[model samples]
Target: MARPTTLLACCKLYISESRNDAALRAIEQAARGGGGGAVVVNRFTDDAYNRVGYTLVAPLTPSPAPPPLRHAVLGMVRAALEAIDFGAHAGTHPRLGAVDHICFHPLAHASLRHVADLAGAVAADIGDELQVPTFLYGAAHREGRTLASIRRQLGYFKPNSSGDQWRGAPETDALPVAPDAGPERPPRSKGVVVVGATSWVDNYNVPVHTGDVEAARRIARAVSERGGGLPSVQAMGLAHGGGVVEVACNLLDPARVGAEQVQGMVERLAAGEGLSVGKGYFTDFSQDKIVDLYFRSAANTEG
Candidate 1:
């Protein structure tokens, strides 16, 4: 049968271990199963955060059986859950689980509903098979809940230890809200996972010259939409080692607000505090770029 042209799905997973290249390789290997042409668009590791992010893209064609893209993502999640032990995990990044966060984005002709369906499927598998607590966000949830709100309710932004480390295990056995899947009590080793489907978002970070995380936090709040700054933007301040702090931001609508605007805002905020802002960075490529790359790769493989 000829391959059907279809929408693209991008699965971005944030695993707890950044220093272990072997674990990353294991996840990648699992994602490449069944001869699926799932492309790894980006793989980033932050030692200070002790987290790794892998962005995988694949064509999502209708099938009688489970789709290859979905299978690939679940395989990777299983691999990550097995490799990472959140009980001993510690990092600057705030997380609620070993898998931490997994977000599915629609690219090309894909609809939000399409990705949301996939998110729901993954959540079910993670809950039923893996027995991990799973929360749904964005379009996946009927309430149109945001990831930030869920994280906030779960105390995800707070660190269990000084210098942003969550050690030994999550503090609470009971969640503020019952998870969409799995047991209500968080697992000791794996904790819980947040799965969502949302429109394309850009993860951008702006570095500041100062070492004061509190000042960075102030700047982050000042420039966030919640703080009455930019619209469709979520910002957080974090220490990135080396006497430097960063304003990590998620630009929900790049067309409405993008990395440039975020950089400008951070610069303006830093200047008022006698701090200098460094050039910002985008952790992943745009959705269009990722779709283009996937097709080019598919074409090459066909050739």
Candidate 2:
């Protein structure tokens, strides 16, 4: 069979493990090998959040053929599951598992359906082989579920331990909803994983110069779509270091709503509360930027 032209698919993994950079790097290396040359576009680690975000891209295998992206993601998850213990993990960010969340995005000419298939395959592997409960969201979900909805159902916002810390396993064997893969009950230590596929989205954060988390939460509500703010936007108020709060936003459609608009709205709303807004920052590179970097690295490797 002839090999199809290469297309791009990006995967983002939110891991509960980040304190050890070397361990994360080892997982990334294993992921690259499983990806069959997937590029690591960007990685961000937060000590406060006690989490890490890894963005990787690989060429999509032809239709009806097993794509390396699935293998790549599973390899990373396996490494994470082995190295990280969620029972002793704690972070400000809401999480349900060691490998908390996994999202796949189609780039270039790749279709959403293609990435969705990859998400499903990875979810199954993590659930069955690893025996961790896994939920599907976004395009990979038949009901078109959203991540926020699933998180809310899982009591992610609530801290089981103390002071924003999560310890032990999930409280109940009976979850609000059945997982798409794995056992209905969550296993010890690993918890559960949320896997999905969607279009390119930007995660932007704007710092608020105030210790009042309530004010930040209020601003987040005002800037979110549910709050009748911008279309295709989601916002959250998070506590940063040094008495500073942040308005973290997810731009679902950059064409519809960009960082500038989010920043403007946040600044305007924060000013009403006498809070000044700092410059906004994106967590990862844009899809176009990632693709360009991938090609450049590929060229350098070949040369």
Task: Judging by TM-score against the true structure, name the best candidate.
Answer: 1
Each prediction's Cα lDDT score? 0.87, 0.85
Candidate 2: residue 126 Cα off by (Å): 0.7
Point out the worst 10-residue segment of candidate 2 by lDDT. Answer: 1-10
Q: Estimate the overall C-alpha local distance difference test score of candidate 1.
A: 0.87
Highest lDDT model number:
1
TM-score result, candidate 1: 0.95
Clashing pairs in 1: none
State every prediction's TM-score relative to the real structure.
0.95, 0.93
Misplaced by over 4 Å in model 2 are 1-5, 63-65, 160-169
Candidate 1 regions with alpha-carbon error over 4 angstroms: 1-5
- Prediction RMSDs, each to the true structure: 1.9, 2.5
Candidate 2 — which pairs collide? none
On the 0 to 100 scale, the lDDT of residue 55 in model 2 is 91
